[model samples]
Each structure stands twice: as structure tokens, then as C-alpha cells.
Target: MDTFHFHLHGDVQPLDRFFQNCIGSCHAYLTLREDWREHARLIQREIGFRAVRSHGIFHDLVGIYQIPWGGERVFNFQNLDKIYDFWLSIGLKPFVELSFTPRALASGDRTVFHYQANVTPPKDRGEWELLIRTFATHLIERYGLEEVQTWYFEVWNEPDLQGIFWTGSMEEYFDLYALTARTLKAVHPSLKVGGPATSRNMWVKEMLDYCAAHNVPIDFLSTHHYCADAAFEMGEFSGIHWRGQKAMLHDVQRTVQTVRQSAFPNLPVLYTEWNVSPIHEDVYGKDSEFTAAFVLQTVKDLSGLLEAYSYWAISDVFEESGPGLTPFSGKYGLVNLHGIKKPVYHAFHFLSQLYDEELVSDAPSLRVTRSPEGNVRLLTWNFVEPVNPDFHSDYPLSGGEREEEIVLEGLQGEYEITCYQVDREHGNAFRAWLAMGSPQYLTAAQVEQLKQTAEPSVCDHQRLILDGTLRIKHVLPPSGIRFYDIRRVG
Candidate 1:
């Protein structure tokens, strides 16, 4: 049994900005798929993510470049328009990863992903600059300067991951970033541009130094972090290992601190890509109670440290390693291919319901907030790092459930308490799927049933008359989260 105390007081701090409102995907060009579009709309309507960030916007599949009979290259925005229109219609602005060199502009044959995005730098810097300038101008003219100014133009995705995402050296990446930044800024000085969107928090200080030395504009700093211990190399799944939550928190904190200590101290930091594990094939890691707990823990730890943080993806319509056939195949998405919500999705949904007003709690596992109307909310989780033998345990809740007694003082009135919980037995569709024999393919009715059961379960409402002290008891399982909303009664 663990006892915790929350002291509700008038003193308050502004809630951290919803930095997690941005989410990423490998299917940026899949906006044409009806199911994909529906999934995007559902995520927007439910979770209300503000921006969608993804790669492949400049890939040949989108048909952005053409070499005419005159041996001159022309850039087209017809497909780009369709993609942006779909996003805007769903109320999602583009975070805009300007990436994957179009084949005509590419310097070499290097490529990555199922669709084979060109990983090479442009053969000619000036031509690349023209392409960027033309694209930026088109966006500004179509969306209006004021509207486009709000969008983010991340120069490239993980340029530091040489030989995989980029075929250039670190110096070359710096040059590319500088050229891209200068070009985008040239189009409209107000256009927000930033990056070196590196994985595992690489290149923050060096990027700042390069931009400062070269006199290039950097509106924000961007990078990524995952809970895995090391970077993922192609064909290296067997070597993957969990680094635990503490390491992930330390990495993020250090990354933010690095940017803050740099010459551009005021620059906002956006973690454009992040997840519990970078190894996409680790099915259990992606679709488990541990991931949900990791989500709650990560957000709680990194809340005020960055301007924006995007989970690696919104849906599993991804195709970096090709589309996953199984529903719960350890893909990097909040929702599966069938559009069923995972535990991590429910974690964000719970977090979205919290009020901005602050309430004090010393426990690391708990977040307490007080509404301006005097309502109180407490979100707590029991998190166990998925490592070794612990990872082999099918149901994390089996022996790890613990009783928690929460005591709130300085309360003088009657209140109603509503508890929303997500654990192995609640708000976990993957676990339910396992119970149903881990079906490789599910019928429509089965899918609907799982969808209905994939939400956070609400406990029976409890009303309490408090004189001066309030105490409530809850049993929480390992990798479980509970959000308690307390409303003062009239």
C-alpha cells in the first residue's frame, strides 16, 4: 500500500501548453485513402490534435516535380494541394516536414522506406533553393501569409541518422538546413522554419552553433526521443533494448537544457518524433499497458520543457516498413489499422480532459490540478519499465496491483468524484484481442465490439461529504492510470 497526500490550495501555476497536440505519420501522402482520411478525421474530432507532421511530402509519389521538353524543371502543387486540403478540412494544420528529395533534384541514388524516399541531398543547392522558394510562395499565396505563418516547416527528418535517412555527413546536413531555412524565410520572413529533426536528441547544440555562425534563421529547435536505449539501424531489431522511463526523461531534460543554454535561449523546442520504443516491430511494446503508462509518465515529466511534442504517429496507416497486416502488430500508432483505439490513445484523451489550473502534489506519479471554479482533478499512474523478465509477463496487472490511499486536506464541502481508469483489464483493446485468441483478421462485428470496449472505463460515481479532510482509496495495477475528477457540490 502506498499513501499520498494532495493539498488543494489557492496558489496556482499555469498549466503547461498542450505540446502533445502534434502527431506524426509515414502516410502523409496517403491522404487519398478513404479509410486513412476517416481515421485522420476521427483522431482530429476525438483527440483534437492541432497539427499533423509527417515525411514524404516531397517524394515522387506526390508528383511535385517534372522535367519538361525544354530540359527545364517545374514544380507542381496539385497533389500537394489535395494533401493540405484534406488536412485543413479535418482541422489539422501541417507541421510540414520538407523532406525526401524529389528524384529529379536528388544528388545520388540513396533511398529509404517502402515508397523509396530519396535520402540524397539535391545535386545543385541553387536548384533546391528554387524548389523550396516556389513551394513556400505557393503555400503563402494559397493559404494566406497569416495562415501559413502559423505552420511549421521542419527542414528534414533525422538528418543525423546518416546512411539511412540521409546520405550526407553532419556538415552537409548543417549546410542543407541553412539553405532550406534561408530559402523558406526568403519566401516570407514570417514563415516559421526550424529543424535538424534528429532522433535520440542529437544535433541540438551543433545546429544552434551552425545557424548562429552562418547567420541563418532558426525559429525553433526540433529533435526526437524514444525510450529505447540506442538508435535503430536497418535490420537491427534483435539488438533493441528498453532504456526505461528514467533514461527517456533524462534524455529529454538534457536536450531541452542544451537548447536553453545555447545562444538562442528563447527558441522553442519541438520533439517532432517520440514513442515508447523506436523499434516499430515490437508489437507488444507498441500496443500494451506499458505504452499507456509510458505516455502518461512522459507527458508529466516533459510538460513545460518543450513548445510542442508529437507522438510518432496518429494512426497505423504508416508504410515505412510496409503496412502491417495484423491489427496489433506493434506498429507506431495511437490507433490500429482497423481504427481501434489503443491504451496510449485513451491516455491522451484522459490528459486532454485535465484543467489548466494547478494543485500541489509531491508524488512523482500524480498530477493534481484545480479548476478556476474550484473543481479538482488528479491523474495518477503506476508505471513499470518494460525490461527483461517483466516484459515477458503477459498481463502486467497480475501481481503488481497495489492499494493507494489519497488524502486531500483543506476541503470543507461536499464533492462528487469520478474516476476514469485505463489498465490491462480496462481501456486496452490489445489485451482484449489476445483474450479473443489474437485474431490475425477480425470480422466487422468483432472490430466494432473491440472499439466499444477500447475506451477508459469509468468507476461508479462516489459522493462524499467532507468536513475538513477527504480520503479516497484506489487499487491501481502496474502500467495503469487513473484520472479522478472532483466537482464541488452546491
Candidate 2:
């Protein structure tokens, strides 16, 4: 049995930048798809993401680069116009990841992802600078300078990874960034831009030093992290290394500390991509209670460390490798291909409901916040990452139940208590699918049934009369999360 003690405090703390609101996708081209757009809108309405970041805006798929008949090479904004317009329509600003060398501008044929975006360096740096300036100018013209200025213009994605995402050396990437950043800033100084968007939280120091040395503009620092033990080797689906939540938090803190000690101490840090496991093929665990717990734990730990953190994806419409075969194909998404909310989706949704007024708690597993309207919300979770014998298992390890006696002090009057929960048996679509015999193909009826099972189960409302303190007992299974909303009534 575990004990958690919480006290309601009169002191109010500013709400930390909870990174649940910024999310990412595989490619900018996907934003043009009807299904993708539908899912994006659903995420915006449900999860409330403010900005979306994705790769391959300048890739050939978006058709931004061309050498027309007898005319010099020029930029095209047709597809870009459609994509940005759709994002704006959905109330999401772009965290534009300027990436993937366009084929026409590439010096070599190196490429990545299922879409084969050219990953080689530009054939002409001068032309690259011109392209960037023209692109920025076009965005300002179409979206208005005031509006476009608010969006992020990241130089490139994961340039420090070596040989995989980038075909050039580290020095070359810095040069590329300088050209891109300088050109964009030259177009409009207020247009925010930054990058070296390296994977596994790399290259912050080097990027900062280079930018400072070269006198390049850096409005914010951008990078990514995954809880996986190591980088995923190319051409392999090695499953998840599963480093767990504590390790992920340590890395995030280290990254933040590195920036704080750097030449640009006040520069904001944005985690352009993140997830529990970077492996996109671990379908079973990816959609399970374990992943949901990981999400809750990581977000709580990252409370004040980031300006924004975009989850790797919002929907499984992603196709970096290829289209997912099943509804729960372990692709990186908060929702499945059928658009059913997974347990992790509910985790974030519940997190979004937390208020600005923070309360003191002795338990590391509990987060307490009070609304300005005198409502109190308590979020608690039991997170246990799979290890040793259970690490290779497709399903989450079960039966680590925690019984906690929660004592809340400094409370008076009658209050209404509403609890929303997610565990192996609730708000978990993967578990529901398993109970349905792990169906590879779900029928319409089966899908509808799973949708119902995927929702967060609500406990019956209870009224409590508190003279000075309140006590409640909760039993949570492994990777279970419970959110309690308590409001005073007459």
C-alpha cells in the first residue's frame, strides 16, 4: 500500500507550458489528404494542439521547386498555399520544418522515408538561399507577414544523425543552417527560425556556438528525443529499446541545462518530436496501457522545461515506412487508423484539463491543480515500464496494482467528485482489440464496439462533506491513471 498526502494551498502558480498542444506529422504533403485533414481536425478539437510541425515541405511531392520552359528555376506555392490554408482553417499554426532537398536542387540522389525525399545537400548554395528567401517571402505574401511571423521556420530535421537523415557532414549542416537562417531573416527579421533539429537531443551546443560565431539569427532552439535506448538502425524494425520515463526525463533536463549554460541562455527550446518509443512497428505495446502511463509520466516530468513539444504524430495516417496494415499497427499516433482514441490520447486529454492554481503534494505520482473557480483536480498514475523477462513481450506486463490512501487537507463544505480513469481495462483500444481475439481486420460493428471501450470510464459521482480534510482510497493497476475533479457545491 502507498500513501499520498495533498494539501490545497492559496498560492497560485502560473501554468507551466504543458507540451500537449504542439504535435507533429510525417510530411507536409499528408496535410493535403482528406483523411489526414479529418484526423488533424479531430486532434485539434479534442486534444487542442496549437501548432503542427512536419517534414518535406520543399520535397518534390509538394511541388515547390521547378525549372519551367525556357525560364530560370522558380518556386511554386500552389500546394504550399493549400496546405497552410488548411492548417490555418483548422486553427493550427505551422511549426514549419524546412527540409528534404528537392530533387531538382539536390547534388546527389540520397533520400529517406517511404516517400523518398531527397536527403542530399543542394547542388547550389546560392540557389538554396534564393529558394529560402523566396519561400519566406511567399509565405508572408499569402499568409500575411504578421501571421507568418508567428510561425516557426526550422532549418532542417535531425542533421546531426549522420548518413541517415543528412547526407552531409556536421560542418556542412551548420553552413546549410546559416544560409537558410540568414536568408529567411533577411526576408523578414521578425520571422522566427531555428534548428539543427537533431534526434535524441543532440547538437544544441554545437548549433548555438556556430550560430553565435557566425552571427546567425536563432529565435528558438529545436530538437527531439525518444525514450528508446538507442537510435533505430536503418532498414530494421528493432522494436522499442524501452529506456523508460525516468531516463527520458533525465535527457530532457540535460538538454535544458545544456541550453541554459550556453551563449544563448534565454533561447526557448522546442522538442519538435518525441514519443515513448521511436520504433513505429511495435503495434501491440504502442497502443497499450504502458504507453499511456509513459505519456502521463513524461508530460508531468517535463512540466516547466519546454516551450513546446510535439508528439511524433497525432494520427496513423503517417507513412514514413509505409501505410500501416492494421488499425493498431504500432505506428506513431495518438489515434489508430480508424481514428479511435487510444489510452495515450485519453492521457493527454485529461492532462489538458489541469488548471493554473497548483497545490502541494508529497507524492511523486500525483499532480494537483486548482481552478480559479474553486475546483480542484488531482491526477495520479502508476507507471511501470516493462523490463527483463517482460521486455520482449508484445503485451504490457500486468498485475502491479497499487493501493493508495489519499488524504487531502484544508478543505471544507460539500463537494462533487468525478473520476475519469484509464487502465488495461479502460480507455485502451489495444486491450479491447485483444479481447476481440486480436483481430487483424475489424468490421464496422467491431470498430463501433471498440470505440465505446476506448473511452475513459467514469466512476459514479459522489458527494463528500469535509470539515477540514478528505480521504479517499484508490487501487490502480500497472500503468493506470486516475483523474479526480472535485468541485464545491451548496
Candidate 3:
């Protein structure tokens, strides 16, 4: 079998305390009237995010756009300084979006989705260009061009869909991008800006070709992919178990390779929006267990090619069929809005748990020893699902409850191997909730219980000593993944 080594990339989000832990924006942040600093502190505690993107910084600016659920609460320049200060305070940067026309500048009353926040682009080309320039100047003046130069400013959100989110044409999107890119660069020149922030490989070719031809000041390439029901409808895969997972990844791999060949050789691919499923139906994360397993394996596959990957939004929200809400339908959340951490969150947690040690390329199988102090990690997958009908994670998993047989070669004495796994029962936390009919809502106390159960079961698997490479037969089932800690016995 072909083997590959990977950097095991971690997804960045403000929804948790990871890395620089910068807090930023969300659809909910729009509803509050809280002091900016207070909001910033809350973000610091909750999201640990590194960047903030305003929903409508460069759109029309006249009549108000109605937010279907919250009424007319989100649009206001009064909170600009407050928002930016809190952003810098938490040490997170801005991923500014030049988007959704403000009602004031919107040429028509037609809005995408329902909120009316989906303002149409400026009817007059000059008016649209002016909006971009004004927004650009405001940023340079407030944050100072030098400091603001570091932020990533994307043009808009998913312009390719063009129904609820945008009522404009693709040609219009390109024109908007070119105008916005030029204005932002002209103001700071050093500021990083790019977009085509559409989904499922939209505009990659046109955007890349356009930038190369017009010298449109492109800096990075970004898009999204959620194997929601709609995604699979676009592409076909072979199997539903292990092969299904490989097939899922195969599609992503194909997209990346295509970009490299045609337009974006130097541009980095940033999946700004992605998750297992876009909406909730059976399980909060429908196929979350599958996504959890794919998380680890795909990182092993795409870490080198992809730069930054952020899951769609932090929490769950009302996905109604109206305006001002997420234009597309589905629950593309990393964590449920209730703040209950889901399996997807934990999968990321497990990936982050892996150490960035120099890998042994020739090592054929997964190897790892458990315990924070232990120095071994062994990783392997059954490319094919485990046929062992006896294996399952029933209740609280303990040390001995997990058992399997494997042949180890090049061994002289006994050794210890620590094991960790994400299986059908253990890794499918979201499904567990679903099977139980989605608890009348898990409380803080109840959430603690679930978090504990979701963690991996680790224990030493006998003792063995080996001098040369060894091959072993082992059993790992539950339709997911597992790891082991191997150590030389004294």
C-alpha cells in the first residue's frame, strides 16, 4: 500500500480556545447591543478565534435592510471602532469582507435570502466603485494603512450562487472584485486582498484567469466544500464505508490538482467555509462520524496543498427559507449553537492532540505509545472496514474492553502499546444524540457528561520488544479510526 506523511493541519476557529485564540464575528454578534470591549472579552473566552469579518462593510448604505428574525438591529457604523478595538485587543486579525450592498446604496429593493441585508450591487458602476473606495479609506484611516495592511480582505460571500446571496451576474462579480481589489491595494498597497469566495470550486478558473489578465492584485484563493446532500449530487463516489471516505477525499484531491494545472500554481487554497453537512436532519452532523474519520486522513492528504481551513460558522442557527439568513440551506456548524461541542469539534481536538514529530517515512504501519510522557504513536487504517462483527463501543469504554490480535515481527521481549480510537459508538457523538432523540437540550452539567464519554479510551496493549521492523495483524472496528502507543519493554 502507498503511504504518505503529513503535517496534520488544524482548523482555526474563534469558537474555541485554540492557538492564538482570537475571537471575531458571527451572525449572532450582529444582534447584540453590548459594549464592543465586553463582546471582545466574550469572544476571547468563547471563540479563541483569530479573525473577524463584518457581514456588510462595503454594501449599499441608505434605507435599512430588515433582518427577518432580529428586525433592524445589525447594520450600523456606530460600532465600527468598538468592533475593531475589541478585535485588536484579543490579538485576532480581520478577514474583512467587501460585501452585501447596504440598503442606502442598494439600487433595487430585491434582497437575497430574507434579511434584505443581501443588498443588490450599486446600480451605477460609479456608485459601486465609490462604495469600495469609501470603505477602503475608512479602514486605512481608522486602523492606519500600515497595520491594516496585514488583514485579509475578501470580496464577497459565495457570489456564484447568485440567488439569495447575490442577485447579480458573474460578470458583475468579477467587476466588483476588480474594483474592490484595486481600491484596497491603492489605499494601502501592502494590504492583502483576494476572493472569488464562492463555493464548490466556483470562479477558480475565471477568477484566476481574470486576475492574471487584468493584474487584479490577487493574493490568495478561497472557497468552500460541504459534502452536504447537494455536494454528493454533484459528484459520484464508489462505496459507503471505508471506500466511501476515500472516494470523498478523492474528489477534493481532484479539485486541488485541477487548480494547480490550470490557474493557481502559486495561490494558496483556503477553504473558508466547510463542514460534513450543511444542515441538520437525522443527526446534528448527519454523517459526522464519517467526517471525523475523514478529518484525520484528509489532513494527511491535503495539509501540504491547503493553507488555511475554517469550518463554516461556530454555532447552529435557524435555517429558515427567507432573506437575511444563510443564503444556502443546511446546518454547516462546527459546534451546535447551544455550545454543546459536537463530534466534529472533538475530531479536530484529537488531530490537535497529535504531536508534530518528525515522521519515520519507511514505517509501514501506524505506531504510537500512550500517556503524555510516552514517546510512541502508531497509526494504520483498514482501508477496508473491519469485518469483526464482535467489536463495538457499547457503554463507557475501559482499557480491556478494546481487544484485537496482531502479528509482530522483529521482537525479542515484551512491549507496551497505548491505544486511542474513534469508532462507531465513541466517535459518533452527534449520532448518539440523534439516536436518543436529541436530548431536550443538554445543559452545562449534562454537556460535561457527553464530553467525557466522547474522549478516546487509552490503555497499554501488552509488552513487546523489537529490534527490526515488525508486521502485525490487528483488529480495529466501529467504522472509524484508532491509534496506539508502542514502547520497547525492559
Candidate 4:
């Protein structure tokens, strides 16, 4: 093998939970009522995330009593204590989205697609504001204001998109955002308030402008993204590359640049609603495993460029009803609707384990590996399975069989390298699940069984020495992701 650059030391810290839709949505879709206990237990014990972005609130397309939009299944969160209990019991901090106007408050003519979104401002702002107060009061009464305040309060979903997400204007959004922000701040000034959660970089500009002109408080910013290609469908992938991966980070990069240019240099940008939409295409069955590795790489590569990023959803929710879904509602997710963990979920778990710092040992040529010294715990996974951007589609993607090496340079002397890999044989339970076919769904019990069995097996490979270094060589597995736990044994 060849040497790369920079010795890696300290580990990277884990970000909070990645946001998704309703907890009830995931619960219903994932658990067979009987297995709810085991399902909740297994999921809660899973060390991946401590937070979740519950989707489809405040947008007014869905009612408060009903399951929020995005969830295909209609669930009544009417028993506030019941709903809150479920989440708290599972050990989750809600990234609350102040959302879709309830039908009762919606303007007579205002309503959107499947969600029946009421984009029009409430006919009675007082009533609507009261509703907000009520919700907050309930949460505080249940979870305590101090506890609930720990949650995020994003004003609304993407209002910048005219047709689908937003029927309101920038000015309207500013008004809504300001009102929501003030309400939250007034209720508990320490509560975080930042949103205008629009898509593909829409609200950043207007949001900043509004906050600046109006002097509103923004704790953190949130947004969303998807692969830039829309031409293909259902596995028709042909020419897709990890370049889009770069594009993912680049979008944040540009946002960061622009923010710095505009004097909001310290503003943190959060990718709140991303991944393949409609909740099925990008993730699900067989196509989502190798994305496991991509998950690690993408997050690691983009960590510096973003403050926080969520992978749209944890599991596919019930809002995926075709009857109500518009032209392109089939988005992607890290996991699927079955409650079984996707490769991406596993990878996310792995990435989350990385400590908050990265230190690379200074190495020779080959820009891949970092120096062996430092406090960072290095976790680099190679996706033997190409991370085709058209990841979930039915067509062939831009990656093919190939050979590559990442040299860890700048080793002072001998070092102990432990490696763990997830591939067809190790962590590819999805492959087995896929064989079960579409109608194939796992009960929470079955899902739990799989989770218990989903541990990675490690093997020791040959070691080489050069200029005070050690090299490990092995064939990267098919659709495999190899993680190196590099430590100094000298």
C-alpha cells in the first residue's frame, strides 16, 4: 500500500438525532402492535441518535389531532400525554416543527395536496397563537418547560417553494417566522428559534435579510436537500457519481461562504429535510446497504461544512399514501418503513460513535489516509458497493468494480490497527430481508431479532512496514464497507 497524509488523533463527536416525521408513523409502520414493547426497547437502546425532527407541523396542511403530514397513516396525537410519553419513554428529544395550520384554523379556501395544507395565514392569529401557547403549555406541563425548551422550534416547512411546499410569499414567511420566533422566545427566551425550513437553499437569503432587518433572534438555521438529478426513475441509474456527494457538501460550503461574506459567519446551517423524498426510492430494500458506508464518508467529509445535518427521516412514515401524494412524494430515508435498520442507519451509528475531534498523523504522498498520531479516532469506510447518487433507483449507477488504496501516512513507529467491516456477509441483513420481497415486512419482534444479530465480525489482515509504517491489504468486500479502528501499538 502507499502512504497518505496527516496523522489522525482525537475522535469526532456525535451530532443530535437526525429529524424525520411522526414518531407514531415510525411506530405503526415498524411495530406489529404486539411487538411494540420490544421495538421500543431495541430502538431506544440503539446508540445512534438522541434527537428526531418530527415532520409536518405548522405548515397547516394537517390538523393537530391528526398525524402530522408526511405520515401516510392517520394517527391521533390527541392524548398529548400519551404521545409525549411514548417519545420520552423511548428517550428522544423532539426537534419540534411548529407546523401546518390545523383545519379548524385554516382559511376557507386554503388547503394543499394530500396534507390539506392551509398556507393562508390563520383567519384568527389570536386563536392560532393560543393554539401555540396551548401546545407549549401542554409540553411544559408534561415534560417541563426547561425540558421542552431543550427542543428546537422551527417555524414551518419550506415556504419558498410556490407550488408544493409553500403557497405563501417570502414576506409571509418572514411574518410567520417572526411570530413563531417571538412566541417561543417569549415563552422561554432560551428556547432555540430558527427556520423557514425551505428546500434547496431557498430561505437562507430572505431569512437572513428578515432577521437582520427585523432584528429577530435565530439560534440556528435549518434546510433540506436531495441529489440534483430527476431524469431517471425506479432504478434507471446510469451516470451518477459520488461527485454529487461533493455537491452535497458544496451546497453547505457555498452557504457557509455566503453567510461569512454577509456577516452571519457564525450562523449554523442545519440540513433538516433531505434524502430521497416520498420516503421510498432512496432507501428501503436492497439498494440502501452500501449507503451505510456512504453515510460515514458523507458526514465525515461534510462535518466541518455544516453545523448539523439530518437525513430527512429515520424510517419511512405513513404519509407516503399514493392517493394523497403529489407527482413526486416518494422521498428517501436512512432506514425504511419496516423498522429494520438500513445500511445507512448502521453507518450512521458508526459515524455517531466518532469522537468530536480528528487528528491525522502526517504521512507521505497519496492524499487518502491521515498521519497516525493525534487524539482523533479514525473511521474510514470503503464502499465496495458504489454509492450511486441514484442510490435507490432501479438503473445502473456511475460506479463499477475497481481497486483503490488509502495510505495512512506519518506514522512515528509501529501502530495497532483494528478493522471492522460491514458488507454482504457481515452487516447485510437487508439483503436477506430483500430476498423476502416487497410484501415482506418484519414485525417489531422480527426486526428486534435482526438487530440483535446485526454485529460486525472482524478479521486480521497482513501488515507491511515502510519508513516506519504498517500496511494492511485485503480485497474490499462486494457492496462492502470497511472501517479501520487505527490505534498506536508501538
Per-model TM-score, in order, reads 0.94, 0.94, 0.68, 0.74
lDDT tens digits, residue span 42-127, model 2: 87787788888889999988989987667788778899999989998988998899988988889998788899988889989888
- Look at candidate 2 and give me any clashing residue pairs: 283-330
lDDT, candidate 2, equals 0.82
Question: Per-residue lDDT tens digits of candidate 1, residues 1-490?
Answer: 7897766774667777555468887756877777788788877776788898989888888878767656888788898999999888888899999888989889999888788999999899988898888888988889999899999999889987788899889999988888999888888799999998998788888999988888999999989887764645662434555676787678878887888888898898888988877766777678988788888888887767778889888888888888887888888888999999999887877777778876655567787788767788888898875445223334223347768898887777889989888888998899999999988899999999999889889975888888878787888888888988989995
Tell me the tens digit of each residue's lDDT in model 3 across 353-401.
Answer: 4544534343322422233333444455332222211111222222222
Worst ten-residue run, lDDT, model 1? 389-398
Alpha carbon RMSD to native, model 2: 2.2
RMSD of 4: 7.0
* lDDT value, residue 201 of candidate 3: 62
Candidate 1 similarity to native, TM-score:
0.94
Kindly list the per-residue Cα lDDT of model 4 for residues 329-413, writing each as its tens digit. Answer: 2334444444455566566555544544444323211112233243223444553323443545532334443333554444554
Worst 10 residues of 2 by lDDT: 388-397
Better-scoring candidate (TM-score), 1 or 3 = 1
Model 3, TM vs. native: 0.68
lDDT of 4: 0.54
